[model samples]
Target: MNVRKFIAATARDALRKVRETLGPDAIILSNRGIPGGVEIMAVAARDMELIVSPRDSVRPPGGTDAPAGGAAPELTRGADRAATRPAEATLRKPASSWRPDAEVPLPAATARPLTDAPPGGEGTSAAAGAAVVPAAVMDEIRSLRRIVEQQLAGFAWGEVARSEPVKTEILRQMLGAGFSPRFARELLAELPRELDAAQALAWVRGRAERGMLTIDGESDIVDQGGIYALVGPTGVGKTTTAAKLAARCVLRHGARKLALVTTDGYRIGAHEQLRIYGRILGVPVLLARDAKDLRATLHDLRHTHMVLIDTMGMSQRDRMVGEQVAMFRDSDVRTLLLLAATGRGDTLDDVVRAYSGLGLAGCILTKVDEAASLAASLDVVIRHELRLYYVSNGQRVPEDLHLPNRPYLLHRAFKDLPESSPHRLAGVEPGLMMAGGGEGMLSVGGQRG
Candidate 1:
């Protein structure tokens, strides 16, 4: 690759030089400070691409200036032009003592063959056998790129914190309330920059509230009357939520129209628990061990106005989750994933991803009363765009289950932790948390209104 070394009194100046010369498409190979200024090694993006994937540089055995078939003509022209140009040449010097006095030329491209010719000489086979970049080299390049990107990101986030204190504060508050950094950052990306702290907070709240998908009265499952399955990870209160839905259905359409089914034969007494709920509500409880049994049971209960299935609750990592999803999907049962409000943010994300194969009809928030904060649950819901159907806060079959209260939920989600709370994020902790995980931190200069 034709790498060039540029030096200036500051990184910004050095980068400007790179951009001016390389058309803003230069790939920074290395950047560091020198004795009196900053030094950067960079290559034109097009040149780097040729080296990165050398097939475009490979020529036919006839020795003509033709690239292998399927290579871009522009790239071929550039490769030819590069062959005649003198690469950057500079004396190697210790960065600690080096000074920017003269231009340093890159090494000749011919010295480093883009692709190695096979023993039979440069032939069609040689063109086909293009050089493969070493895994170690690629890994090192990625590591270097990531380090540069993170450094730039940290600097940019620091700038945001300085210039947009309200955004930074609200981000801290969101993290303290257990909202994922990805969601919080995304929601705040559109906040008008002119808004004050209170206005910004209000805007963020309004945005979050609007993003949340909730079930309306007309779309309530009990009123609509169809087969629905409550599915989620173990200990998320799926069985209890199922009973609550059953009771609601019974009250709305009478006991004859509601039937309870359990696919949780794995847990001892699991069926018995659903059967108890059924008996108390004067509803019939049936067991369906597998897909076949589930199909037959659904066929038998076709006349019922509503059938609520309590599925086996396994760990999201359990392979059987896929099977359960397939069973419900094949039976045409709409699934409502039961997510515990108290679960950790990462755990909730995992559950949603695991059960989201064939797609969920919606989701139900469980253990709302037990959670210290509803931000995590609501965050996942809004991000995954899952429709919130019901909120289960207590053990009471019907009394505790109610339609989603959007206002209350939104209020609870943005509720800050107590000042004395140890879990509350303060100072730079929030910024670090948002920037720590590499998964979803927006890049520097990313879209943020």
Candidate 2:
């Protein structure tokens, strides 16, 4: 059974992708549009077996609950006759009498629609797999699908989640912890049937831990040498995060090995805030008023082990973000996005999409202390394949920011779960951290083979 999510620029393109990944038998479960394109959720025909049995499979002849053949019930006899009628008819027609172009009527429920049929024409022939409904008919079908998917997106998710106990429990935990319902559904769509509830949850938690990239770099990134800049939407704590990074680098490598630069002349005292932190940490702070100044500053700071740039905060809607990204890209600066965990999942998704072209060097999670749930932030990181280098929960210089062990963070996601709740997932077990983890969070400039 295989369930997958696909995104593309158009319905046609997305459906084509669905066919390629999930095969011709894929059933589209849901779809909706986002910032730049469409998102479609589909399950392969085999995956649909989880919901319904195969049509060709038979479960013993006759009604098994019946008496030992006192007599087959009348309804049962009728069903048996109906089932064999088609085969009887086919056998009665000799091959020599069959016409090549003759159209045989078929039951509408079992009939395969003809492909390439003219608009409004009756279906006359069947293609290999697709029902070649008229273009207008297809359009109407797709439109109806979209409507149903949209309506079903929010309503009645519980009924689907309740199909199986283990998955239901896992879904309860995930939803309670603030994970998106779509994300929760996809995660547990293919649970192993053999495992008990505890083992299943352990596997799920282990899976989530593995998907998150937790690095071992000294203080996340400052230990490794690089010219980097923190970029994100306003109020995500980019400047504060920059200061925290600078402080960490200063502690390990000393003030002499690092430099602080700011390109935030737009905000009154933006540079001043970093400058104050620089003074406390005894690191030099420079201001780059524009891209020209930024390039010049990078040239001078080339001798430093790590140059941490604090760029101005702007809404993702601003054009300045692209300009800043351009500056960082041209100067060989690794850009790190500061994400606010407190923000809504959709906003986080939007921010990641808006800044994705920056060639992000991983992410720094901020405001973990404030967010009611980290699900949205984590979801964005995992879905976008963004590397998470560090997390900050407070304003205590380098003290609040550090790289968390993947298991520790994964455990924290489920820490507040109720013990008596139907979904009692005991945090991600420790041993599985290594056995089931390590698929994400690459170090700067590193790629998984």
Candidate 3:
């Protein structure tokens, strides 16, 4: 393989040289800082094809293929016995023809991290001579790429801070509020790029609110009564949210119009808890253990104006989640995934993904009163396009479940963290976070699959 080396003062310049010399499809093998500048070793994309296919053994830069007798003379030298072994035959290269410049120490990227033998151990010399690249080398290349990207991100961030201080501050605030890196970056990417900090922040709020899908009073679930189920991961307040919705339904259309059902046979006091709430509002509570039971219960309550099924709380990773979803699949049931406002962004994302298959009618934000920031919850809701049905801030059944207050949620989402708080990112950390987002940072839409 023809592996060419390029040295330049900066990573950008070295990359440009690689692209110009080897075309855009060039594969970067390794790169690192040297005494004068950075050194990058790369090979043509086409050349990499030869390395993987053992039949097309690695050929020297300007030499013919080795004779059928065996590898070239230099490969069988006394000091490099490993190269002569049949095990290393496919990767055998004439040692005399290929050698990196001696100006610097060996490149760390060439070493194999996964092999039983350590990177610089006995077999490394033979492994290096073998042209087939190991997975570890690719990982090293990716690590270097990330480092370069981070450096570039730091530079880009500095430029933005100097030229667009308001935009920079808004980004910092969004990240501090618990919004995902990609979400915050996408929103900021579309900002007018000319507003002051206050104006920019307002713009961000407006954009976020517009992206949010919320139900108004006219389309309120209670007013449009139907058989709805509250589903979600364990301890996200599914039973509590169900009771809140039940109370709201009772108040609007009367207790006779509302019925509560519990599928939580696993939890100790699950049925009794919903039963207590049912008694308070003069609503009857029913229990359904499985899909067939749920269908029968729904059939029996066909005349009831509204039926609220409080499902069993299970981990999002549990296989029963699919069973629960399947139970409501063929029925007229529309699911409302209960999301806890206090959950982490990734955890909330997982919950949304796990329950999204229910053809979610919408979602209810539970435990809002306890969340430090609503940014993470709002992030998942907006990205998944889940209709925001209600917000349950407190345990109070009828009073706590209220229509989503868009302005208040937005305010809470973008609210900055205290400067003294350890959770708050400071200095160049925001830039690093955004940079690490990679291709996601460049994407305009914030939605994720």
Candidate 4:
């Protein structure tokens, strides 16, 4: 087998070299990142053919060929050991000689992440030394190219500022509200083709409200009550939100109807803090360290009308979130992911994606009053299709939490407007927006999908 190594400053350049030197039918054995650049292993298809096949019609790995008028090959310990032998032996064969699959080992690509494979890859290594096909590598390359194009297609605001001052100002308002650039650009793209300045915002405000989802028609979470567990990253006001839900339950029904259970055993004095709130509300607080403990605790509090579980604080990046989510499998509990409105749009998007897969009932947006703009968090909620159950603006127990109002949110988007707004759009002439080759135009069809 003739193996060659190609090194370049980038994967693309290295791959180009492999194609030029080894021809189109070069098999890539492995690739790795080094201090200066990337390293790729390649060999010509003909060379690989000599090494991988013992006969003209080569037998596939882990399979056997039948001789004429003979029974299937008998299984034996000796045959099994030969089948599992290392690939190094096949590679170390006498120069320019063919070998069987018995000595070939699995390719290194199988051990690395899917992304570590060659860019324009198709199909796996055939019999250890077979060259990878273009079909496999091109699939990943196409995907990467699409992503790059999408990012480069973002709204070029700097060029837009040269003309169309009115449309530019509308974009300014969207960004000022703390919405993500991708989301803000998509929203503006959906506007009417010939819309005037006055009509532009009215169109967007209506679209945003319709996009919002909710658990019940009203914001009252108790309307569809069950075992509710508040799960999210640290410092999103899960405890306070849980307390507020308990307070509402207590006010609507009596103390006997509400029960507070906490699984926050990690933080120091965490259970103690929940117990203090339990004392204030005159409700019992229970602790559960593991899945079994949680099941037992809920079983003991089975008679209670509403059980609010205050979960421990954890980073969304932690793998334990999957374990924590799985704990509710044995029990009948609905998950409510808590989010902070002050969070960045990208962070909120990641948080929602991480928690949304757990069959969440909905989400509660907290610290709205502290957020410079609610668009950041709201954009993520709308994009992920997660329903908004409640919004918290203050520290007050039950008073701060309220149902989401579309009209109120729309009003807030355009709040504190300058008096010159009406006159701003009066000066721009027609066709000025298209002056810069139309690249500055918002991609009207690019919605949150």
Candidate 5:
């Protein structure tokens, strides 16, 4: 048997060369890809007759007949000629007729050896038989590891450690808006490494999950024939929201079937402002001084399909907070808490707590167009588990207020920001920094710090 190793630019070409030089009977011992292409090792039994053939002209056909000193020169010349010949042409030649009776020598086995050895030999022999990974493959793996380490070393992992709170706050807000924790984590993980303020905001918007709000499938408003109050803190557009609903009811049930009621008797021009809306919509406006007056007004409008109650904006700390809640207690009326999208987090919380006594049927989110983070308002709303009834974006009656749709609300929560608002790291407040074990903070780059 004879063994040979071959290297070529590709695996296919190397295999072709082996077959040509070693004949069709050659056995492939090993083949593998290397940096340059492929390497193949093969073995073939020597054709003894071919060795003595005229083409070789090395040993005499009669075997060992030539003087030992003369044989060396002839053998060296034959080897040189064989090396110089084209591999394909050599492989095309016919086998020599001078066959030898002696057995051919066996080539050393190139197969990966077994590592499992009988008991005592395990330690030393098994180690020796272990398969060796090629040097080229080892080098490639090392190079990849180095590249990853270098890239990671340049990142500011320390900043991420400090900003964990901010990321948590962002995640908390997302969760409060009805996003699942798993979905939030997956999305936040993909945030970019660097961002400006506008970019960070954009990243937050992009990473937020959709479908945060739930909508009532029934399109028609329930006809519970008593005063339905719109109560909330200052500047939440209650007056406008009431007008929009009044218009909708009138459009569906006729002007005579609807009435407008104002319990905001304290605010200057509150009655007069609603009066103006009443005149245009052609619905009657009634002024209620107290809960007793409210009940009386309800009785007067008994024929009405809907009666919209607009209350004066009150501070959460105002002594009148409970008074307003009392106004709806004994009446056969539904109450709604109105919230402004532009209001602060704490302020929204106060409003919700103040209105808790009224048995709020649902909530109306107003001034969405003016808010920087609508999710903040939504966070408060969903936390209380209040059904969202309507959303008002502008002052336009009937046109601006829309029946809140869950999918639409989710889209708003996670929609991408305009190109003008990129995320940035500068001007971030120190208080915004996340404390250890607190909620994670989303950085301007969309990454949790």
Candidate 6:
């Protein structure tokens, strides 16, 4: 028997070389892909008799063939072919020179004929023919498992130890309000590590405790009586929030002191929506087409104590953002940018930037009830240093709007008392405690507790 090695750019080329050099009867031993190309091993025999009738004839001690039908040939010629072959070689050689050996060891647990057995076997075969797996393969598998376990353990510990207190508080609030825990967890994990684990957790808890509709900025201010415009992007509930604030003013002052103005002629029922709210509240509703018309309307309603202007919902991409800004210019009306809590950070920034030319008084956050997290909104508010005035939750007027008191807002936003745990009220003050609270009661009096 003779063994040879061949290498080629591809597996096909290497196999072709073996077949050409050793004839079509050459047995392939092994083949593997290396950096430069494929490597293959092949075996061939020189004697034609050894290649033919391999299973039936055996080579005696002097290389003479045994007589036919005599107690089976002892050293089957074909057995040598199987013995010389490697396990990794998938292709089989021609049966012309192959034969079964009388003393060939059978597979340990085969129920079928040995002919159906896989190429690699226990006896009368090369060590490679058994296809024994290398130790490195097992090592690689174990290494991968360890790496995965390390990653999971790190994540779990960070979540429970470092991130648990704050995340737990925030998650409790969100879950209490019917949010999916899986989604809440995913969002929390994806939050950028801008704040430390403690601060991030605290921020999340604050958002949950504050409720979706609660505002986080200054709300108490002397009403400088004049026309005030509420402007924001499309679908942020500006009209509804306007009605809420107007209702609050009317309840505090009187219906006679308030008037409603709308500049949303783009949508069919936009004007009617505000008009219906005005009618229910017993306030006058006026429409302004442009800056000149807005000026005229302001003059017409000069006697009104507070004029609330509800503008149309315009896309940030709309060309009309500039037009709207121009209309609000040089007017006594103070503009409040209404931001939706669910809006992306970049979109929020764009809205604020586009409307900055209008001399914004501050920002009013709407649809707080619909947001999963308020970090993006809070970041915008704090980064721009814009005062937050009101937060609106529902469509109900005078009920959903709240004045922003930082400490109170923060306390509510961060409040999460575990029901099963003992109330840890060690440092709490009497004024900070709620009227009917026990454990986890937070009291805010315009200062940190």
Candidate lDDT (C-alpha), each: 0.72, 0.62, 0.72, 0.63, 0.58, 0.57
Per-model TM against the reference: 0.68, 0.59, 0.73, 0.58, 0.51, 0.46
lDDT: worst 10-residue window of model 2:
440-449
What would the per-residue lDDT of candidate 1 be over residues 261-325, giving only the tens digit for each residue?
A: 88888877879988888889999999999999999999999988999988887899999988987
Off by over 4 Å in 2: 1-163, 415-449
Model 1: number of backbone collisions: 5
lDDT over C-alpha atoms for residue 178 of model 5: 38
The order by descending TM-score is 3, 1, 2, 4, 5, 6
Model 5 is weakest, by summed lDDT over 10 consecutive residues, at: 94-103
> Model 5: per-residue lDDT, tens digit, 271-305?
89889999999999989999888888888887777
Tell me the tens digit of each residue's lDDT in model 2 across 178-290.
66555654566566756778887788777777777767864456777788889898888988888888887888899999999988888676688888998999999999988
**Clash count of each predicted structure:** 5, 2, 0, 9, 26, 7
**Where does candidate 4 stray beyond 4 Å?**
1-168, 215-219, 413-449
Give the candidate number with the greatest lDDT.
3
The digit string of per-residue lDDT tens for model 3 on 108-213 reads: 4334343533333323444334434344444444454445445444544554565567777888888888998878877888788668888889999999999999
Q: If both were scored by TM-score, which would come out higher, candidate 1 or candidate 4?
A: 1
Arrange candidates, best lDDT first. 3, 1, 4, 2, 5, 6
How many times do residue backbones clash in model 4?
Answer: 9
C-alpha RMSD (angstroms) for model 1: 9.7
lDDT of 6 by residue, 1-449 (tens): 46799988654466678777886656554555567766777666343333344432233334443345332232343333433332112234211112222223333322224444224333313222222222343343334333322332222222233323444344444434333333345435534445665677666555444433333333343255667899988888888888887887788788898999999877888899889989988998988888888899999898888989999888887899999988888787899899887777668889889898898888887777787555556556655667788766667777887775555444443344455634322211111222112111111111111
In candidate 6, which residue pairs clash? 51-97, 78-99, 87-128, 206-413, 206-414, 210-413, 432-443
Alpha-carbon runs more than 4 Å astray in model 3? 1-146, 440-449
